[model samples]
Target: MRELYVKSLPLQDVIANLAEAFETTYFISCHEYRINVPEGYGSGFIRGINFSSGFGLIEYSCTFKESIKIHFSVNKIHPLKFIYCSEGIIKHRFEEKDSLHLIDQFQNVVVASTAQNGHILLFPSGQKIHMNSLEIARKDFKTKIDCDLHYVDKNLRKLFRDLNARNLFYYHGNYSLAMSECIDEIKNNTLLGFTRRLFLEGKANEILSLQINDFEDDQKAEPKRQILRKVEMTQIQKAAQILKSELANPLTIKDLATRVGTNPTKLQEGFRFTFGATVNNYLNKLRLEYARDQLMIGDLNISEIATNIGINNKSYFSRLFKSTYHLNPKDFSKQISKNVLLEKL
Candidate 1:
């Protein structure tokens, strides 16, 4: 019932040390690199790419029977770190900081630290850990040959400047579905050989691009409403899951709001803030995307596909599909067919 701080290391050394400290084996190939700690005594897996271009990724999931504290150092070369935790609690504090800051599940933090090399990470025992780290080497990024970070946030661009300002900065917020999905695709990618290396590099850049672009979009789109309480945000997100799952019968925003015990205005505002889209827009995009997938793979005609996605009127469905993709359902299916035939040829 008491708290504890467990272990710490240089930020870059975490993966190597984890492999050495635990009985895990660190395996590498042209495709990917991973360390697997077999079941019993904090079982987990850390798998990602260590690209030569100075950018790196680490995807980790573990469950420890005891609390853990990971103290780490960051040098000036790669002073900024963007970290996302898909699940579990992540507590971090800099050396000069008076207190710890929490990065909750599905949230991320962009860290810009002073040249000082002292930071600590804390995770409670008995809680599962799921995390993804996208480490950017500022030195590498500052050069055009190594990488281009033009679209990254201004705070990140500061790392490239030759200045004496090395103050600590941490930008924390929720990770969008686009970013979460991109990470999943990176982890699940099955290509091999040189193609895998290219894929890794591409996906790594994509991770940065998605985070940067999505955060900027949110800043512009988010409404200036009073902050919702923790319970309200949780309720709003839960309401979103309901909308996603119950697509067969759409619910009015007012009805959805009522179901989650909130008024329509707060529900709509909270939904946009939490998910980065209005309730109606999110649902519309979700339905259309699902229908597009079905068109490519399912053995159904355009009308059937329309009916399958809960649209009783086929013409209305076609219009919606065309508006979203610039092609009606049937034409979209035919284009996919044409591409498949070309591949076979």
Candidate 2:
């Protein structure tokens, strides 16, 4: 769907004037600017938080029955903004001449800090939109981050003073499993009052953190992937599907290539080219995500979930799970208690 790019700002500043059409539930605490707009222009909410560490978050999930182009007229240097689309379709463009980019299902786009330029997002008529938009103030994150944040400092620049350096940087990739789960948790969480607001705020932060983590992980794992033919790309994607669908049955590189009509080297190369990760690394990420999904459902214990995924050693599974998710299986389960109730209008 085509979108109109009227004058736009960098999302955060566009709030006070967010289509006076909707009746909104707005809340601001020491760390959050949480608002729920469920009336006037269809139903949805925009939840935002400014963390003490300098980075911040803003999440947008709405279903619109009308056509409107919300403008983010950039006045100052914009921070790094990450936009994720789990459902529906969205079109984005930095300037008038630039081709409009689409972030469809299971895809995300990153916009690096650059000269203050307007950006726009269109909610085409009759579209059910579900998306998460995160803004990270690089300067704030930089102050607290002693460890190299991969490419953050370099990729996001203050080009106003540095005339020689290019002014634009952007990144596009598949949405990670952790991000998907966090979005699901935000959309479905039923807690109320302070508890509900806090839960949503925490989950939104996780979405941003996971996406950055995945970006660096992918960068280190796969750099400078070789080009492939269209047909080879298709076969390689098939191998990826096999990995995603058959998580319990661990398939060797040769087996996957054979099943997809390719050799192991090509399989390995193509997996890197297509997903920015080797087959084994991609499989591990997917399997751990699968385990997380199982844990979220709360049907099985840690040991049982590990065995279900063909990991016989519960201790080993816990270690792997903790390394990736920053929390053990037991802790994660307790983190998502079923007692919380969803908020209703």
Query: TM-score: which candidate is best?
Result: 1
lDDT of each: 0.69, 0.66
Measured against the true structure, the TM-scores of the candidates, in listed sequence, are 0.60, 0.56
In model 1, where is the ten-residue run with the lowest total lDDT? 1-10
Report the error of model 2 at residue 224, Å: 10
Off by over 4 Å in 1: 1-14, 38-40, 74-79, 145-153, 160-165, 218-221, 224-345
List candidate 2 segments past 4 Å from native. 1-13, 19-40, 147-166, 192-205, 217-253, 257-345
- lDDT (Cα, tens digit) per residue for candidate 2, span 73-155: 55655556688887888877774336777778777888653466656676666777777776655555555554644445343
Top-lDDT candidate index: 1
lDDT of 1 by residue, 223-286 (tens): 4323343335777877888877887787888789778876676687686767678898888887
Model 1, residue pairs in steric clash? 6-69, 8-71, 9-71
Worst 10 residues of 2 by lDDT: 156-165
Model 2 residue 114 distance off true place after TM-score fit, in angstroms = 2.5
For each candidate, C-alpha RMSD in Å? 11.3, 14.3
What TM-score does prediction 2 earn? 0.56
